[model samples]
Target: MSYLLTAPEMVATAATDLDGIAAALYAANAAAAGPTTGLLAAAEDEVSRAIATLFGAFGQEYQAVVTHAAEFHTEFTQALAAAANAYAQAEATTCSALNTFETQLQALLAPLLPNAGAGAINPPSITSIGAQVAFIMGGTGIPDPDPMYVTGAQTLFIQPRFPGFLSDALHTPEQFWPTTPNLGNLTFGRSVAEGVATLSNALTTQFSTLGNSAVVYGYSQSAVIATIEIRHLMAQVTPPSPSDLGFVLTGNPNNPNGGVLQRFTGLYVPVLDVLFNGATPPDSPYPTVIYTNQYDGTGNFPQYPLNLLADLNAVIGIVDGTHFYVGLPPDQVANAVHLPTSPGYTGNTDYFLGLTQKLPLTSLIRPIPYVGTPLAELVQPDLRVLVDLGYSDYGPGLSYADIPTPASFLSVPNPFAVSYYLAKGAAQGVQASLVNLGWLPPSYIPTGYPYAPSVAPGLNFFVGQPSVTGLSLLTGALGTAARDLGWIPPWWD
Candidate 1:
């Protein structure tokens, strides 16, 4: 057999379309019937019908639940295959070019070997271990749909950033980063509270499997989880390794759950620490890089477009004016961890990774200003060191631009916004998402989590009807009272 030096491992979790069957049954008239006339037959009909109805409903729900998950998984598999092929072609061409260039260079100079010309050669054999991987997590809200697309784009984008060391153009993400199928336990779309444990477990699994250091990257909500988990999920636990690096790019929880008032009060950091099993994150050798976006004041002066919308919604009682807060600077905008949606004014992008300043019309006029998502400022010092990607982050090749924020109304069709972002992702010519919407577009941008309503009647609904959709605390907590703490679910087990 031809010895295989390296290959990308295609990872996949089967798309399970859970089986279901529906049946309608009725017994023949007991007096006239032969098979159906008996008591057993009557029982069978009733049981069959009941079971069919429930099972059918269960099947539909399961299908609905897995719909996004399965679609993204397929996209991921296909994208990886395409990326792997692209990488292979590029690598072959590059190697051939390098070989030709090296041959000519050797003729001009001396041969460069494992050792530089003159030292005494000893039995210094070099043993090699496999490559290290860097798994980047995406922002949240609608889960399951985002991760894979993020990964696909990430696979191509991450390669160029590490020119100093790794240069495996043909490598796949499984070989380069995350080495496995899970993004923490982010497979099923669940709220962050419930979602964190899965991510924690995923990290534990990767570290256990690799036994070598790796990079962990998290953006937005993913940043929060990665930051909290750095100490615990690191490869060597107590004895940290320099090889491990956790990049918590952006995810700033500026105000507790943003401006939305919760039914019950909960401390943001404290709750995190509790779930993480300590008052503070433990110190580790792995370093973390944090990239924050600055506040944009453009939406405030003439009045942000969202304010106008919020005003209209308030007049009709769609949203209460008391609870809805706007007109704050970008940093103060409680967007939790995402870029402010529908930025009315063109804010500055000085904080973006690789954007250049435009020259002014004249000396009197100032250079065009820039800004980024205000969430990047948040960082946790307890766990790891922070490397802030300031107004601009420059590597060897490309610049990360604060591509203009799209201004649109709620009425703006999603496809319109989607096409724009996708084009941007493609045009930027990088493996990054269009302004970090993750791999896939958000399924839905929830206005708020907990979604607690200050209205008492809403609170009554929450407490009285736990199963109510849209209005329940699980789905929507439209209440002023803390009848339900609405604690986030499925903390790391």
Candidate 2:
């Protein structure tokens, strides 16, 4: 039997390159159309007229052939793109089916198997009688000895770690460090290091002694600890399988695109005992889910600091308790948006963005009485557009929404889109404000979870509205403005 190996990513890239080639060809053909197809006799002579007519005919025939070729090229590109999508979907479906089958098979064989299942004929002598277990770790400020914090008794938010599997299962708390700040209780590094060590030992023991699978739940500071442990496990000669071990990190500062730690990777604050330890491993062997709240300063920092408005919004988010995921209702957490990963991403990691219903700007102003809410509603729509520019619309591990990212100085903003949003936002803001103030009836019934205004609007519009024209105009405008103000440098490009 013969087999064929296919890489969907390569196929997709080829299709993209072909499309570019077709576009260039089309542009070149159009430019030559008038000169090549329009016949103009050189001296009004018969021979000159004949020559021009013959060449014009040839040019027309060539154009007809080019059109057919362009059509075929477009169809081929579409087919290739579809093939890539199909292949990706097939792989995902297969993995899901296999996982489900494995779980079902384990459950069915539990009573008959000898020490092979949670309730097997000859089960291991352990406190918990389960094929899988969950470990919970608390964030900073929670005391180490507090049973509620340790055993996840009071952390109702993290109880739904793995919805179907681990919700009702045994939850073992791995609390071996001081959960307080460095200056107050223990040094931050020492505290996190201790948690990492404890969790590592616990996981190793569970795998060896109980011969069971396990999932860990980490929140805030403890999420950082989990990140460190994942790195350690990844470096091992034989790491744990995705099925055997999994991780759930909420408000993780080690998030690659937006985590505060990753935002200032090389920076360290001595007095605060905080080190920008960098991001969590994106290509870990264990199944991991990172949950980041939209504007949380710790988990989702701005990618472009030049946008001061975005920076202020993030700071407000921090003050508004956007980082606190411990008390959020289970349904709200479950409803978080699943972020998109890079194409052909084979790593065992998933990212989620928890959308903040109220704009951080609105939240900041909503403290005042009657006018506060209405006033904020009036300005939020337009202001959101400006803030959205501070982030990249499409990238690995990003949601197709108004999400934030770490600092990226090289990125340029689309000035036309900026202008469009400003106009659209102003209109929306006026309408919303009027509704809030009872001037106009509500256009849409408020669903308690109000949808924040997004640049992309939905998942289908992932590319948003950016164009070459917009970029060129923006660059030109910037240059012209700078020149007029006598601020243009000779080295400026």
Give the clash count for each candidate: 21, 1
lDDT per residue for candidate 1 within 1-493, as digits (tens), equals 3422112111111111111101111111122233222223224577776765665666556555455554555566566666656655663564456445533443444332111122111111111143455555544432332444444324433332321223111111111012223534332213344445656555455456544344554443454455445534444435334444333333222111111111111322222222211111212334433223221111111011233432332222211112111111333332322222111213211121111011011111222232121111111110001101001111111111122111121221123222322332232322112223344223211111011111010101001111112312221322212224444333432
RMSD of model 2 against the true structure: 23.4
What local distance difference test score does each model get?
0.28, 0.61
Error in Å for residue 231 of model 1: 4.9
**Cα error, candidate 1, residue 35 (Å):** 99
> In order, what is each prediction's RMSD in angstroms?
28.7, 23.4
TM-score of every model versus the real structure:
0.27, 0.58
